[model samples]
Target: MANAHMRKKEPDKVRRSLLDRTAKLAVDQGPAAITIQAVATAAGVTKGGLLHHFANKQALLEAVFADLLKQLTDEIDRYMAEDPQPFGRFTRAYVRAAFADHKLGVRSPWAALSVTMVADPGMRRLWSDWLDGHLAAHRATDDTPLLEIVRLAADGVWMADLMGQDRAEPRDMTGLEPQLLALASRPPSA
Candidate 1:
């Protein structure tokens, strides 16, 4: 059943704004800043309005995490579509997407979502479930040691950025993507 919020004009627009604001807040202030009142003010909505869209802060956080995952999924799919190779295609696409997604703004909310994800067990489960399913789906092509290593390397870079351990200057990592792609271009070396 739908609610009054769903029946309003451009309700999805409002909902998206709320989610975006929530992600921004998460990145800027950490998970503790995702309160309903703060999210409402960030979205330029009333507490009642925010509540109408999201039952509670938890619900809103779940929705935001889910939305961010959806965006990443779409990005990976886009990269796969453009890729010319078959073997390790998924791995290659994932590396490009993950590195590209680490940016702070311009629709990139991974760092923020990652912070919230670490604090919430349920959200972590959501991520694990999604990752398990995705990896299982791509296992045929991405199971090789080379591809796995490449993917893990990409993860390491992203993780470093997430932990504020190292600045991810793409230029500094020059030729890195090509090297990964070249490795991904091969079949099982094992």
Candidate 2:
């Protein structure tokens, strides 16, 4: 009976292992490099074992995408919890989280999974749905232009760093956070 209980937990472990391996491959070699056999080999599991957890490559990539969104959402939530101001909390938290991820050498799953999204329409729809839901949940009350600008700038900074375009000796992307936050704090102009 104890063994049976333990067996139930094993699948989740195996699933996580497979997803981690797939994410690594997607980061290191691009999503094109992710295949059932390749992921299984990278994860030290047989192809059958990987398939048991993920019905196919699409399923595996979907899981990876979902996990990535969850991590980002959780990080943003943590930042929001620390921020007192309600007006700019979402954009501020987003910028801070992106910088934190870069400092920690964490690769965004969206970069890694882009190929899968391009290859599979279903994956794109899944991602779109997730983003739509996230935006709906975190919708800003004021909807100021500065908030949009700050978010766009943050995305540009993140993309530049992700693509190795930010050639500064010390990455100080966070330096812009205060300025953006200031803009976010102001009331919309008449």
- Go through the candidates in order and give the C-alpha RMSD of each one to the true structure: 4.2, 4.2
**lDDT, candidate 2, residue 11?**
80
Model 2 regions lying over 4 Å from their true place: 1-9, 105-111, 114-120, 140-142, 165-174
Candidate closest to the true structure, highest lDDT: 1
State the TM-score for model 1.
Answer: 0.82
Poorly placed runs, candidate 1 (over 4 Å): 1-9, 103-107, 165-171
lDDT of 1 by residue, 48-126 (tens): 8899899998899889988888888998999999987778989999888877865543245677667668778989988
Tens digits of lDDT, candidate 2, 1-190:
3243345457878889998999999888878788899999998777877888989988888888888878888988898899887877777787787677666543656666755676788887886797667666667643567877887887777666666634556566767767776776776668
Clashing pairs in 2: none
Q: Per-candidate TM vs. native?
A: 0.82, 0.78
State residue 158's C-alpha deviation in candidate 2, in Å. 2.0
Model 1's lDDT to the true fold?
0.80
